[model samples]
Target: MKQTIPGLIAAIMALSSCSQRTTTTNHVKVKENPVNTKVTEQALDKGLFATLKIKNEFKTGEPVKLKFTVYNSTDSVKEFCKWHTPFEPLMSKYLEIKEANGEEAAYQGPMAKRMMPPPASSYQKINPGDSLSVDVDLLKGYAVQKPGRYTLSYTGQGMSGLVVKDSVVFHILP
Candidate 1:
């Protein structure tokens, strides 16, 4: 019976983990357009990681919407500056989108001047195992109206205090 207890506990733990699924929970950053969306990212390291969620496809002229989510996977709370992320009003473009052929989309947004040591208002705190998300219309800052497969990633040239280690790829159907 010694082995039976441990085996039963492990079985239950496995089943519980398998039951959890991606969702738009109360922690949802925004719900401007509540279409079905799911976790589109996988972590590249421990501590904190970022993910971009987008539809697998879109129609030309339609809003190429994106959801930027930052998850804290560690046991402690973490905070970071929100600059260059969708968490704040986007004055400067922060994403680099490229076509399948490696052509980069042009930026046509206004760039804002930030004061040294971004004010406390510019930071966000995420609790352990919790996530924060924000919605941004990709087209608002980038000229990406063409219908084609495009890959989007954080430029890493000063995009928030956290690094977006993962990216997402989607297609535009004309």
Candidate 2:
């Protein structure tokens, strides 16, 4: 009976320790701070403008939504291949994300090192005074996992020169 009691006590201690570790590892403590929405815009060399918008606060483990828009003010049409945008190939050539510590987010997927002949239909043509917008979940699209402040920048270009470039900031909560 004495041996049984000691064994039971040891089992309880082990279980308690395991539970504590699990809770400690799973619970993410976030620092509370007042944040404001960050929005920025920049005009490219051409008559194009780029805008970036992001929320000030975010919940930990939740996807961060990023909104990017490109506006063309020129009288002619602006054309870009699918590889240059985040449409099908999901390329990030123009988009850049950096953590608060200035560490840039690494590109998560395979990047095209060389230009390939894309299908004719893969080209997106924007008419004059038109705009193109993209909504992306930063977590799934960019592998943003930690809860902290992040900066996002976008540099869009056409076959010519620079089209648009802008940057914004956002925060992730616990």
Clashes of each: 0, 0
Please, what are the lDDT tens digits per residue for candidate 1 over residues 1-174?
998999998766543321212322344232232222332334323345677788989898889999888776655566666777788887887898999999999989889975555566767777656688888888888888888999998863243545566678999998
Give the poorly placed runs of model 2, Cα more than 4 Å off.
Answer: 1-45, 113-119, 155-162
Q: Could you tell me the TM-score of candidate 1?
A: 0.70
- The TM-scores, one per candidate, come to 0.70, 0.62
Summarize candidate 2's per-residue lDDT along 1-174 as a digit string, tens digits: 989999998766543321100011222333221123322233333444445677888888877887656555555566555454554455545567899999987767655553333446656665565677787777755756777888887643442123334477888777
lDDT of candidate 1 vs native?
0.69
Clashing pairs in 2: none
Residue 101, model 2: lDDT of 94
RMSD of each: 14.4, 23.8
